[model samples]
Target: MPPPPARVPDLTALSLLVAIARTGNVGTAAHEVGLSVQAATARLRTVEQQVGAPVVERERRGRRAGRLTSRGVLLVEWAGPVLDAAADLDAVVAALRPARPGEQPIVLAAGPTAAEGLLPAWLVELRDGPGGQIVLLDTDDPAAAVRAGDATLGIVETVEPLEGLHATTVDTDTLVLVVAPDHPWAGGSGVDAAELVATPLVTRRPGAGTRASVEAALTAAAPDVRAPAPLREVAADTAVRAAVRAGEGPAVLPRRAVTGDLAAGNLAEVPVHGADLGREFRAVWKEGSSPQGTARDLLRIATGGRIR
Candidate 1:
């Protein structure tokens, strides 16, 4: 590499010298830069040592006064563009900094069910409102993302209350037990919670909101029964639906996710007695922090202006 650059006085010291030249008084320049006169004097001595010449004229008979020598005047003029370029660099760095919530585009983290079924319409409406732009993240744990400040807002489907966050139910969804037309339960009256929990079914991966809701409902309804392992664990709702349509196994999924398949006779919804499969779709944010700017506008639009 090249030789290391030479050390020089920092910007603050140089600016202080320039200020002293402008005001013609050391104490006045010190006050302008929020420094004591004694501290400024020490700093000036350090600057002189670095420059290898006396930059300020010293009075021999009284308190120190700021009177620039010929060298100081020349140094001040040269420092003008250096200080200006430093200021411009500061502005550019600030512009490139990571955006805080509500500062740039609204960052929305959503669970698979909501991302697949709901947010598209709400985002379309937000396009016409004061909300400027949106960056959407499809995640399994949207509430956690919002709580950690990674997302400006979160949409999640759960019956449990979120700790350390504020949540408002914007909509609801139902988990339907679905199977292919050739399955034994396809045309039956329905199965009970015990039987549904005992069967190995196609399911979303462990952290998914859809899987959590179904497991919670099953555990609540049939506390004594042990649930069976999943026939296959898929990553997304569409993949789970595809597995069920291919006769992999029965699966419990968001009704909205399989509406088209159910209507087309490709998948059949089998009822589950003695258990509630309903869940609330909620908008969540950090505790004590209210949505603002684009997030607020999108929330208002999502809730039909009822949440503002």
Candidate 2:
């Protein structure tokens, strides 16, 4: 009597069906739906069995067409109205949980040097501002993260133009020679190009931004000097720092990465003639993704009035 307890089809299978209809191929649709082609085909068959009707017509290995039977079509059409109602409900719930008066939840993706150390002070100031909530994700692939909408903002070392992201120069930072306090060079505040070349160095992995910038400067300064034999190669700035701290060997690091150590006398910045190796930091975001409210305010605070 109670309205036949309502017929319910598996949403996952239904979603896959919808994707298949739009993409016109099982393999392509499977990829969109995050399933393998064989799996999608099996799931489609199961849905058809549940409804007692075919929902798709297969052409080639991947090519498919929505072949909803009369009953299946009726069900598919009915899904539209049901989904619209669900969407409206979702909107209502989201609106009910509206952002606190001025607080914005912002995510920033950046290189380890800035994300782990440099940005904390600025972030604290922003947090004291009107509702500035921030999360930082440190990674070397900031460009990819920015393009994927994984973060509202990204700080990176290079100036390469990201295709769909807007980039603005933030500041220029230099690579400083760093060595453990016990190292022989520790007595000196710096080293010359010849000293750098002759030293057995602990360096970053090949493609790192710091490494690239240092290499370019090195080539310009002494094209004839052979590349230093690396004592060790590490992937992250933190790893490189730990290696240096272990007295591995002399290493090159960004000023931001070694600033505290330099200040504490744990490590000294080596002076090198014409070795003012530098790179531009950039703030990047999706081209049309405008920051609003708290995010906009936080961006301003983080940039420290230098968003030009």
Reference-based lDDT, each prediction: 0.83, 0.70
Give candidate 2's error at residue 39 in angstroms: 54
**lDDT per residue (tens digit) for residues 54-93 in model 1:** 8889788855567888888888998899897676455333
Model 1 local distance difference test score: 0.83
TM-score of model number 2: 0.54
**Listing every candidate in turn, what is its Cα RMSD in Å to the true structure after a full C-alpha superposition?**
19.3, 18.6
**So what's the TM-score on candidate 1?**
0.63
Error of 1 at 195 (Å): 0.6
Tens-digit lDDT track for model 2 on 110-216?
A: 76555544565555555446645566656778888978888788888776667888877766787888888898877765667766776667877775667777777
Question: What value does the lDDT take at residue 169 in candidate 2?
Answer: 74
Cα miss at 64, model 1 (Å)? Answer: 89
Query: TM-scores of the models, in the given order?
Result: 0.63, 0.54
Clashes of each: 0, 6
